[model samples]
Target: MRSLKNAFAAALLLCSAMASAHRFHAGITDISFNARTGNTEIVHTYMAHDVEALLANLYGRQFDLTDPDDQDVLRKYVEGRFWIGGQDKARLPLRWVGMTADPEKVTVFQEIEQTPLWKAGAIHDNVLIDFIPDQVNTVNLNEGNAVRTLTFDRNQLEQPTR
Candidate 1:
């Protein structure tokens, strides 16, 4: 019984430490906005999740974005981790500071921090992305339709379509 308890405690400690140590994918892409900018640059990183549903989530009312609540809804949506920058190349640890958005651009900024996965010094990544927010997102290439998926294109984004 004592050995089992000790083993369990060790496993728990290792797991908790590992959980906090691992890095996660995070960044801002397709950033675009011009409406709200005061204390910080408001940026937007489009997410595949439906925007309409997000509006209803923020202020407890259906939002049309073009309405007055547009900015408020956007602010609420990106409060924690609503923006999707699509920069999944590396496991990035970032704390979103401010945001803004429009149909053409979505940007997010985080203080320079250690990118443990990068092997080098801090990544200092303030990703600014400019791309069409396609609703038809992509899964891994094994699922087929590699041409449609954004991952392949993002890596070699400038390459002409063959």
Candidate 2:
């Protein structure tokens, strides 16, 4: 019984250590064009802790996840890191909407107006890449009825969103 208890305690400690060391470094972005509104909507989702860590490193200050000022800072940071281009390779204008944060995650929303329907475009997403070397950012582009996925990592920074 003593040996079994010791083995269980050791296993629990190992699991806790592994979990702390292997935090996931990733984020997901969803983009869709609204025909009725004539706008392209973009939503980016990230882990709250990861975003807080980023804010601290970038601004040299601690930020409350639910604070409005902190959220604005996050919005500006995300907008600067994310970019989209049309078929002509001209940068599309992005209008920041807002962001919402819960204990688990934070989601930021933005929009680009007057985008043509079903047009091919490209996106450059470098969110969290500067802070985390292994960060993986995945973008999902939704057309009228179809959805396409693009993945960006340390090796590949941008991709076509067709």
TM-score of each: 0.27, 0.85
Task: List where candidate 1 sits over 4 angstroms from the true fold.
Answer: 1-44, 47-53, 57-59, 62-92, 102-107, 116-162
**lDDT, candidate 2, 1-162, per-residue tens:** 999999999999999997797477889999898888998898999988888889999889989867787878887888788999878887788889888888779899889888753554678899999789989999988876888888998888878765
- TM match of model 2 to true structure: 0.85
Instruction: Provide the RMSD of all predictions against the true structure, rounded to 1 decimal.
Output: 17.3, 2.6
By lDDT, the best candidate is 2
